[model samples]
Target: MIDARGPEFAQVLERCTVLLGTLFQTRNDILVFPGVGTGGLEAAVVNTLSPGDPILVATSGVFGDRFARLAEAFGVDVRRLSIPRGRAVEPEQLQEALEENSDVLAVLLTHSEPSTGVTNPLAELAPLVRERGHLLIVDAVSALGAVPAQTDELGLDVVIGGSQRAWHMEPGLVMLSVSERAWDASKRARLPRFYWDWRHAKNTPDRFLAPYMPALGLFYPLENGLHEIDEEGLPRVWERHRRLGAFVRAGVIARGLQLFADPAYASNTLTTFKVPDDLDAGALRERLAETHGVLLGEGQAELAGRLLRIAHLGYTSEDEMRSTLDAIQLAIAAERADDPT
Candidate 1:
């Protein structure tokens, strides 16, 4: 392992942060943490809000619910505006919720709902929150590089991302792009924090060093991944994901499977579909993995055994996606032949 405190490492980190800003389309300060995406969510909560501070959480799927639950755990008064599974959170709905809860200090929104493969309209929703003088914290863990999130243009306060998502890196690092307003809010906010404190993690002494040792091993890979993203170009990357999403959705539909996410707001990174009522979702997934060497994500919580998610994100090629779709078709056909209604 390289010296984490050395200047060489610092340079690598600084470059990664700059690339991260490019990915988020923000010139704001980007903070890196040595944990998973959920840790970034926790950091966003504790850094900007005090205990009992009311906030509106717009939830469209499992990840959204998790963020609301996380805020509740921090003693933040969470007013959850839940949308139906597979449906994006409408701007009108958020406007109404904000009007109803005028005392809310901030708005927690999931940019891309991974569980249901729905991508919320951040451009439409950001103005509603910002116009009301509320902080906008976005969970863009799965959406960052794959989707277009103009953080600076949207005036989002805090946007969280993960290294493992669109970057195709390992799961040891999380990033948060914090706006100037968010930094000011952190000064007055009072909620217990030690490890996740942005103050402690901020670059110090012009050396780009953190108070504590970060995920050293992840830094190199993170830098390399960011460079790869830079080489590909962000706009082109987004277009690729968009095309992949459309291709997967069309393939699924041709196979007679209904999509779980609204067609208008479907995610570019992943596609969720309903499992036929007669077939066991778990067994079908098993058959796909064991026989076809393809693994699929299972539905979470109440939707378990009813939906399956296919991811087309992170360095995946169209050929790979086509093969995955073919595998799904074969697996479903085999399962049906074995248990005919």
Candidate 2:
């Protein structure tokens, strides 16, 4: 690993920040931290909100729920606007919540939820929060590169991202694009924070140094990944993900499997399907990995054992997806044949 404090590393860090700004479509300051996307979520929470501060969370799936829980852990009064699972949060729902919770300091939203393969209607939902003069914090970990965030145009105050998602980089790094309003909130925020302080992260003598020792190893790869995304062009990359999502969804339906997400708001980065009542989701995943060498994600929390998630995020190919689908068909066939019923 290179020395994080060195001039060369500082240069690399600056370049990455600029590239990340392009990715988020923001002119705001970008901060890097040495942790996963969750850390970025926590940083957004601690830096902009205080204990007992009221905020509205629009939750559609697991990640949205997780954001609510994270804020609650900080003693924030979280008013949850729960959308039905497999459905996107409607703009009207958010408007209603904001109207009811006028005291809310900010609004938390998940741009793309991996658990249910649903991407919330951020473009339509963001203005509701902004028009009301509330800070808008978004968990864009799964959406940034795969979909359009338009952080600046949307007036999003804080947009969090992770390296391991669409960037195709290794985990251990998280990035945030912070608007000036978020910085203003930070000045008044009463939440206890040290490592996650945005000021420390921004005001360091060398603007590139993090609050603590940085993830020295991830910077180069992160830069390289950003360059690759830049070279491919954002529109083309997004279209590729869109096509992949369509292909997977169509292939799954053709195989006689049912999708779990609403077709109107299905995620372009991943797809989730309802597992047949007779097949064990975990066993099918195991068989896919062990017998077919294809891995898929299991449903989380309440949906566990009843849903299957297939990711087509970064560096995925149609050939690979076809193989995965074939493996799923074979695994299901084998499992049903052995069913004593």
Candidate 3:
């Protein structure tokens, strides 16, 4: 076990944390916590917003809704501006929401909607939030490592990410970067928080320790993953995901399956497709896993059993893409043969 306070562990922790800022192009203060990505999101809100504080949420998919729900659960006044389940939020709509709500403290968004595989145009949306004089907080858990998310450049107040997605690391670590404005908001925020308090993370001079000890198991994998990212370089990694995403989407289109999200808003990290109406999505997934050894992500919430999501993230190669496509095609073909349609 490594000492959470020792210099050796501190060095590695800093290395991993710095890599997140570099990945997202941010110079803001960062906090790396040991939990699911949602915890980081909760930290973002609990640290910066108080009860009844109004926040506008621009949601295009399930995760964005979840962020808004978290705000509502904490008694924050949530103003939802939503698109369909398989779409991206438009800047104009968010601008309209800002116009409608003059007391909004922040605008919450999901950078990449993994449920429907849509990546919102943050560069366009952030300006709208900033123009309205509100802080922009984003859940980038599924977007950061696999796509071009210029967080600081867009003037975002907080960008949250998880280690597992597109980072080539297992779950257990989540992180967020905070801007000067976000820190100021936290100082004024009256939310009750102990573990999720941003101060505990930002209090120490080095910004390494949590309120308690760090996750030693996650720390090692995170450090190694950061080195892997550093070695590959961000541009190359993003381009690879882009090319692979197109490869997956092309294969899906060639198979005559419809994409769940619009092509323009499709995510480079994952692609979602409309599940054939005649087939049970659960059966399809089970056969693919039990028979073909291919595990696919299921649809969430209302989209469950109606959508199929596939990934083209870090460490996934062209060969794997071909395998995934072939497996999906075969699964669909088998279902058709059984139904005679």
Evaluated with lDDT, which candidate comes out highest? 1
Clashing residue pair totals per candidate (backbone < 3 A):
0, 0, 0
Clashing pairs in 1: none
**310 in model 2: Cα distance from truth in Å?**
0.2
What ranges in model 3 sit over 4 Å off? 203-207
Q: What is the C-alpha lDDT of each candidate?
A: 0.91, 0.90, 0.86
RMSD (Cα, Å) for all candidates, in order, is 1.1, 1.4, 1.4
Q: Give lDDT tens digits, candidate 3, residues 1-341.
A: 56778888877777877777788788888788778889998998999999999999988888888999999999999999989888788777877888999799999989999899999998898998887789889999988888877887889999998878746588888888999999999999998998888877773454555557777877777778878887899899889988988998999999888999889989988999999888889989988998799988999999999998997788888899899889999988887787775
Give the Cα-based TM-score of candidate 2 against the true structure.
0.97
Please estimate how well model 2 matches the true structure, expressed as its whole-model Cα lDDT.
Answer: 0.90
Ranked by TM-score, the better of candidates 1 and 2 is: 1
TM values, all candidates: 0.98, 0.97, 0.96
Instruction: Please rank every candidate by TM-score, starting with the best.
Output: 1, 2, 3
**Residue pairs whose backbone atoms clash in candidate 2:** none
Per-residue error (Å), model 3, residue 155 = 0.4
Write one digit per residue (lDDT tens) for candidate 1, span 194-219: 99999877764476874478778887
The sequence of per-residue lDDT tens digits that candidate 2 reaches over residues 38-96 is 99999999999889999999999889999999999999999999988899998888888
